[model samples]
Target: MAVHRTVEPSTSELGTFTRQNANTIHGHALACLVAADRYAHIEHEIKPSLHAGDTVICDRYLASTLVLQRLDGVPLEFLLDLNADILMPDLAVILTASPGLIAHRIAERGIRHRFHLDPTMPGREVDLYAETALTLTAKNVKVLVLDSSNATPSELAAEIADTLPDPR
Candidate 1:
């Protein structure tokens, strides 16, 4: 699993702002690390293991950046150009749910950041994810959109597994 941190500014630095604040520092810090780690892992473990027909499953990939970064106000084209040289995914699984469900769930678990507290977050995230899935699908990558607000991780894994052909 990999998630690139995009423009993570301290919430305190926002000068006690409201959820409407979309201002961010769009740094490549975490993105750079993920990109590096991805390259290293692919070069070291994944590529070597491929016998021309094997499939690799990643919990998060470039699509994550496009969706999340766009929410942070970074342009989709910019994100893609940032990762232009990186390889594309063969399949993408996008999980979505009602904002109300997500909001209630997060309330139960408490909040994480400005993102979690943002009233616009749930809807924006859902839209970005759908947009990302559509974009990837148009590029010929298979995409499975899962409504995961109800599934446990184990159940989700099982469902995803059914979508892929077993190399075995």
Candidate 2:
């Protein structure tokens, strides 16, 4: 089982996030998310909040930058350029399921973010994530793409843990 990190952003950090909040300009954040600088900032400012050697299962990360920036008309190369030097995850997992299945899941969960506001955004996100997986794999990054159509989170986590290299 993975120990997930929950980094509570300090008031300053939260202010930074809110001040540069991507929602200000985009049709909605999903369409106009500017996550280019967030990856670097997190490592610089929030890394201390996490355990020294824990696996950080980031919810939406650099790939989110790539997708959202592209959606917002930023060039892929430009967006990737901004985040090229940021530390990559050790075991990146891309969960996949049918758009229908994902739609149902989101419908039940009720999101607080812009990404889930539009029903069509989920479909776009899935396609973008698939492309992102291919991009990541090409860079020699190890990625596990799992279909979460029926698997529970525990089962999925176990599958992922089994695939990860031993910490020792």
Candidate 3:
């Protein structure tokens, strides 16, 4: 299994774009553009993994853009249009937890991108993710909403693994 992130090195130009725009939507357009660019860059890896029969688990995929861009005031239609051709996951897992717990986890593990830095972002992210799950479900994508408030990482992985198709 290969794990891919939207920003590969985390210090690439796209990573810089995310960091510089962490607090507000002042740089929303540029960030969205960067996401589009990264999508193209990341596709090479995803395609090869699938061809080689690996289960590729993307840390953040198109669903993230739907939530984050909407938070920046971009309409859902626009975001959807931007990512219409990207490969969809077999099971889109929407992991959720209380905003307070999310904030605490960020504090403990360190913030990844600008979206997690805002003090008020957790609640909004939680709500938007939930909404996005519903929207994707409506569109017939397989979605699994799992609350991580009390589950350990191993337990969460086990639960997710159980959802995978049995090879036998």
Task: Estimate the overall C-alpha local distance difference test score of candidate 2.
Answer: 0.65
Question: TM-scores, in order shown?
Answer: 0.70, 0.73, 0.77
Model 1 regions more than 4 Å off: 1-41, 49-55
Please give, for residues 20-66, the per-residue lDDT of candidate 1 as tens digits.
Answer: 24334333544444445555555554555553445666656767777
Model 1: number of backbone collisions: 0
Residue 120 C-alpha lDDT in model 1 = 81
**Candidate 2 structure quality by residue, lDDT tens digits, 1-168:** 345553312224543474356555563343223343355446554464344555555565666666665655666676666667766766678888888888888888877556667788768778888998888888778889899999999999999879986663
**What lDDT does each candidate get?**
0.65, 0.65, 0.73
Model 1, residue 86: displacement in angstroms?
1.7
**What TM-score does model 2 achieve against the real structure?**
0.73
> Which 10 residues in a row give candidate 1 its minimum summed lDDT?
2-11
Q: Rank the candidates by TM-score, best first.
A: 3, 2, 1
Model 3 alpha-carbon drift over 4 Å, by segment: 1-28, 110-112, 166-168
**Positional deviation of 28 in candidate 3, in angstroms?**
4.7
lDDT of 3 by residue, 1-168 (tens): 544334322345655555565565444574466465557555666677677767667666667777877877778887777777767777788899999999999999997766676799999999999999988888777888899999999999999889975432
Clashing pairs in 2: none
